[model samples]
Target chain A: SAVISQKPSRDICQRGTSLTIQCQVDSQVTMMFWYRQQPGQSLTLIATANQGSEATYESGFVIDKFPISRPNLTFSTLTVSNMSPEDSSIYLCSAHLWEADTQYFGPGTRLTVL
Target chain B: EDKVVQSPLSLVVHEGDTVTLNCSYEVTNFRSLLWYKQEKKAPTFLFMLTSSGIEKKSGRLSSILDKKELFSILNITATQTGDSAVYLCAANLYSGAGSYQLTFGKGTKLSVIP
Candidate 1:
């Protein structure tokens, strides 16, 4: 089990502005993932952020829109660029601990684009 | 494309009642089934089941997986008002090299009314 944390738990930003959300894990993880959840909806995988490599995004998400960075085994950041009101959602980061083979999630960043 | 579906999108039950949530998935190279409870922005892990017929329990929550049936069930016994939230079901797809993709269901909104 790993403890995950995110920065700026909740933020209100203007449309067209970008926001970078940071995620940090307590221990080394083999893989990290980013997810987004819209209101009254379930989570959607944004991308897979593996250390030392480019993030693999899921369909409907792209690097230009949701760029990801994995600098190390325990730290990752996701940037929501050219944000729009439709981009308002809760972004969450998860770390998959190889020892447990389970993915633990961060608190999630709630973004409101006005 | 892989997909996960959850049944009874929303349910309202009285406190002390036992409720069961269902999840059916068709994920390529399925590896595991996971359950999570979301009370706020972040979802807290509840259980992860990798094998069929094996049950994972934690206090009032118990979950079982049926790979043969391609489904899983989460049973909450003696529920409380605190249990009111969205319960998510995710299918973990193994893609080699210890990397996996988690596809989530729409989730079941369980409202435990007092």
Candidate 2:
């Protein structure tokens, strides 16, 4: 199991503003991912953060809206650009350990857009 | 596209009662199935099943997968109030590019009343 942490545990932002969430892992990981969980809904993958490369965004999500940066193996950042009330959701970061079948998740960032 | 569906979107039960949650999946290349328990923040990993007919148990929680039937079930015995949470099921798929993704179900929200 990996120890993962996310910054800005909870925040409230005005509409049209952007909030960047930081995820840091205790050790190096092969894969890092971002996920969103809307109220009363399940988790949805936002993108796969590739180290030293562009992140892969899922369908219905655009890079312009959710830009990701993964500079190293243990850290990544996800920015929710031009947020709206509909964009209010809990953002989670997960890291996949090598040779492990499970992915460990961060505590999650709760964002509320007003 | 991979699809994962969970039955009984929400369930309510009294403490000490037993409950079972079901999850079914349809994917091109199934690699594994995972169960998670989500409370207020991030989800906690419960079990990961890759082979069929093998039961994985942890405490009072147990899970089993049926690859041929394309489904899995999680059972909790003598549930407690602290056991109240949303249980999630995810299917991992091998995408052929040496990468994988998880498709998650809507989750079964279990509320254990005292």
Candidate 3:
């Protein structure tokens, strides 16, 4: 398992503003993923952050709305641009540990747009 | 598209009772199945089952995978109020392109009363 940390545990931001959530892992990892969970809904994959390359986003998510940055193996950031009430959700970051088949997640960022 | 499905969308049980969560998946190049517990925040890693017929145990929680049935089951014995949370099931899809993404199912919400 990986020791992962995320910034801004909870935040209420104004609509049209952007918030960047940071994810830091204590150990190096191969892949980092971003996810979103709407109220009363299941988690939805946002993107896969590949080191030194562009992220691969899932359907219903695009780079223009959620830009990801992975400069190295232990850290990544996700920016929610042009936030809206519909975009209000918990954003989570996860990484797959080499020693385990499971992916460990960081404490999610709870964003509420006003 | 790869998908995962979990049964008993929600369950309410008293403490000391045993609860079982089920997850079934259909994915190409299936790799592994994982279980997580989400309690108000991030989903914490619980167990990961890779091979069939092998059960993974952690304290009062144990999980087993059945590859032939394309499903897995997590059993929590002597459950407590602290065990109340959303139990999530995810499957790792090992794409031949040297990448894998976890497909999650709508979690089963378990509420344990004292």
The lDDT per prediction is 0.93, 0.93, 0.92
**Ranking of all predicted structures according to DockQ, beginning with the best and ending with the worst:** 1, 2, 3
Total clashing pairs for each candidate: 0, 0, 0
Least accurate 10 contiguous residues by lDDT in model 3 chain A: A96-105
Worst 10 residues of 2 chain A by lDDT: A95-104
List the pairs of residues colliding in candidate 2: none
In model 2, what lDDT does residue A92 have? 97
- The DockQ scores of all candidates, in the order shown, are 0.89, 0.84, 0.84
lDDT of 1 by residue, B19-45 (tens): 999999998999899999999988888
Each prediction's TM-score versus the true structure: 0.98, 0.98, 0.97
Model 2 per-residue lDDT tens digits across residues A4-89: 99999999999999999999999988689999999999999999997977888888999999999999999999999999999999
Q: Candidate 1 lDDT, tens digit per residue, A1-114?
A: 789999989999999999999999999886999999999889999999999889998889999999999999989999999999999999999998777767889999999999
Compose the digit string of candidate 3's lDDT tens values, residues B44-79. 988888899999999999999999999999999999
By DockQ, the best candidate is 1
* Chain A TM-score, structure 1: 0.98
- Candidate 1: regions farther than 4 A off: none
lDDT score, candidate 3, position A33: 95
